[model samples]
Target: MSEQSVLFVEDDEALRFATVQALELAGLSVRAFAGAEAALAALPTDFDGVIVSDIRMPRIDGLQLLARVRALDKDLPVILVTGHGDVPMAVAALRDGAFDFLTKPFATDHLVAAIARALERRALVIENRRLRAALAAGETDSPLIGESAAMVRLRGAIERLATADLDVLVEGETGTGKELAALLLHRLGPRRARPFVAVDCTTLSEDGGAADLFGHAADSVAHTRLSRVGAVVASSGGTLLLDAVDDLSPAIQAALLRVIEEREVQPIGAERAEAVNLRVVATSRGDLAAAAAAGRFRGDLYHRLAITRLHLPPLREREHDRMLLFAAFVDQAREALARPDHAIGEAERHHVLAHGWPGNVRELRNYAFACVLAADDAPGEDRQDLPSRVAEFETRVIVDALRASAGNVVKAVELLGIPRKTLYYKLGRYGIDPDAFRRQGT
Candidate 1:
C-alpha cells in the first residue's frame, strides 16, 4: 500500500466520489475537495501529498491553483485533468511545471499510475529539500561534514560515544543542526534499523503534552474515540529525539524524568507501567546546565540526559567548511530554481569569507538564494552572474566533501547528495585525488 496521500479536486460530486473511491480501493489515501478553491485553502506549504485537479473548475481553475501552488513551493506536484478541447492548455501547464495531465474519460487504472508517478516525484523533491536543509545546518545523514580540527574531534567523540548506547544531549546555537547530530548518532549506532522518533518539546501543551508523550488510556479524554500510545513507549527498541528539550514545561519535565528513571511509562487511566527499552537523545539550543541550576529545569533530568554530550561547532569557527558549505547551498538554490550554477568571483568569495554570518548556516542559505536569484539582476557592466563561476565551484564542493571523508566514496556521496556513480564520474572529470584525501595511514 502506498503511504502517500492525494488531494483530489473535482467540481462534479459524482466524479469526485467515484475517483476518490477508486483511488482508495487501489490502496491509496484520498482527500476529496469539491473545487480547486477549497483544495487550495486546505493545502499546506509543506504538503507531502500529490494533488489531482480538474482544469475546468467554476472558480480558481486548476491552472490558477497551479500558479498559486508554484508560488508557495515550486516542487509541489499538480496533476491536471483536462477536457478534450483543453489539451493545448494542459500542455502549457506542463511547461509551467504540472507533474502530468490527464484527459477526460481516462481509465481509473491510468489515473492511479499517474498518481503513483506524481507521488514518486513528490517524494524525491521533498527528500532533496530535506537533504539540503540538513546540509545547510552543517550536518548530514552519514555524520558531520567538516575538515576543521574542531569538527574532526567532534566526529571522533561522537563515533566513540555512538556505540555506548547511553542517552545523548546535543547542545549548540540555534540553526547549528543539533537534531541532525542526534539523527546521525541514531543512524550510526546499534539502533540504526529501529524507529527514530522526534518530538518537539516546545510544541507540546501541559495538559495534553503529558498524555501525548506517555499516551492515554481509552476513554481517558472527553472526545478522543480511541486509546493513545505516547512517544516514549512508541520508540521502544529505537530512539526518541526530544527537540528543544529546554522548552519542556516543569510538569512535563517531572513526568519525563519519571519515565527515564523507571524505564517504563504508565499511560493515563491505565493501571500498569509498561517497561520500555529505548534511547533518548535530547537537543537544546541554550545552556541546559544553567537552566537546571536556575531551577527552571529538573536537575535530575538534566543529569540523566547530559551523561553524554556533543557540542556543534558554529559555521564561523570552521574556516574551510564555511565556504564548502556555502558552495553546496549555492548549488542547492540553483538546482531548486532550475538556474545554471553560480559563478563566484574573487569579490564574492571575499564577501563570503568576510561576513560574520550571525545567523550561521541559515543566513548563509538565504544569502546564497539571493545570489542565485540575482543572476541577471546584478548591476554594472562586466558583472557576471554567480552561475558562470559555479562550474569549478561545484566540483570543489564535491571534492571537499570527498576529501573530508577521506576517499570514503559512500560517505562523500551522502554528504554531497550525489550518487556514488555520479561522484565517481565527476571525480574522473575533475581529476580529483581520491587517494590523497584518504586520511594518512588509514
Candidate 2:
C-alpha cells in the first residue's frame, strides 16, 4: 500500500465495500478489511494516513484496534464508526485519543472530510520526523541564518557598513537580534582585535551610572576608594555596545551625548579629559527619532547615533526564514541538552509559520528548546486537554484547505466539505488571513 493509503476496517461486508468506494471516489487510496485483526496486520508502523474502523466489530473491535494502533505509534490517527447505542463508548475512546468518531449513519462527505484532515496532519508528522533525522547531519555556520529578501538586504547592508568607521544605531523590536547585528559590525570591522564592551543601560544606577560609564578617580564619591576605569574608557580602542539605550535616564543620556560629541571621557573627580578612539553601537527598542522629537531623548545624541542605522527585521517580516531558524534552534537545543533527535508536531510547525512572534528569534528559540525537551508536549509548551487539541487540529485543517485552494474561499469550501459561511466564520475566529496563502501560492 502507498504511504498515504488509508486502512478501512468494518465487520459488515456491504458497509466496508460502500465506504471504501466512497473514499476512493474522494481521491483517497484505501485498503478495506473485514476485520480489525486483518487491518492491524496490514498496518505499518509509519502509516502516513488515517485508520477508519467500525466500533461494534466481533472480537477485535474499533476500540481494541485503536489501542493496538496507539501501541504501534501514538501519533497515528484512528477514526471509529459508532452506532447510536455506542456513542458514550466512542466519546470515551475520543478521550483515549481517538482522532474522530462518526455515527453509523454518517454521511460519506463527513468521513471523507475527516480523512482529508487526518492525512494532512499525518503528512506534517512524517515531514517533521524527516527533518529531525536530517538535523543530525546538518549544520549552520552563520549566526544569522536566512534567505528571505529582507534578510538578504540586511546582510548586504551589514557587510557594507562593517568596514565604515561610523557610530551605528541598531533599532528593532525586542529580541530582533540588535546585539547580534552590532557584534557582526564589530567583528567584520578593523576593531576586531579590540575588546567589545556591552553595557545594559537599564541596569545602570542613577547616581553611579556616570562613574561606571566614564571611569572614576580613586576616592571618587563614596562608592569605592580604588580607581576604576568605566566601560567607555576601558573600550577606548574598541567598540562599545549600549543596549536598551532608550531605557537610560535623562542624566545618563546627557552624559553619554557629551562623550559622543567630544570623543573623550573625563573621569569623575579627574582634572583632565582624555581623548579616545571609539566606535559606539547603540540599540533601542523604540524609534529614537520619535523619542528625540518627543524630548524623551537628546536630539544631538540621536543624530550622532543614527549616522549609520541598521534595523533588524522582526520574525513576522522574515517570512521565509521561520523554518530555517526553527530547524537550527532545534538542532542547537538537542545538542546542548544531549538529547536524542526529536520530531516537531503539526501544531508546532503551524505555529512557527502562522503566529506573529512578538518576541522574535528569542521566543522561537525558547519554543524549539521546549519542543526538544518534551516531544509529546503541545507546541505551546502547555498541557492541552482534548478540546484544545481538537481546536488546534481543526485550525490546521482549515489552514491546509486554504493553502490547497490558493486562498479562494469558494475553492476551500469545496475542499473542506463545509459551507462558505462556516469557513469564513472559522477564519475570523482563528484570525487566519487567507490572502497570506494567496500570496504564497502566487
Point to the candidate with the largest lDDT: 2
Q: Which pairs of residues collide in candidate 1?
A: 341-387, 342-386, 342-387, 342-390, 343-386, 343-387, 343-389, 343-390
Q: Which runs of model 2 end up more than 4 angstroms from their true locations?
A: 1-24, 28-118, 125-141, 376-442
TM-score, prediction 2:
0.61
Expressed as tens digits, the lDDT of each residue in 1-442 for candidate 2 is: 2348888998888888888888888888999999988898888768788898888889898889999999999889898887532434755787888888766566788788888777877787777665555444443244777777777778788889889979999999999899999999899999999989999988899988888798888886795799889999888888999999998888888888889999998899898999878999999999999999999998888998899899888899987788878987988898999987666666778899999999999999999998888774434522356666555555766776777779998987876666788888989988999999999999
Q: Give the local distance difference test score of model 2.
A: 0.83
Compared with the true structure, all predictions reach lDDT values of: 0.80, 0.83
- Alpha-carbon error at 344 in model 1, in Å? 2.1
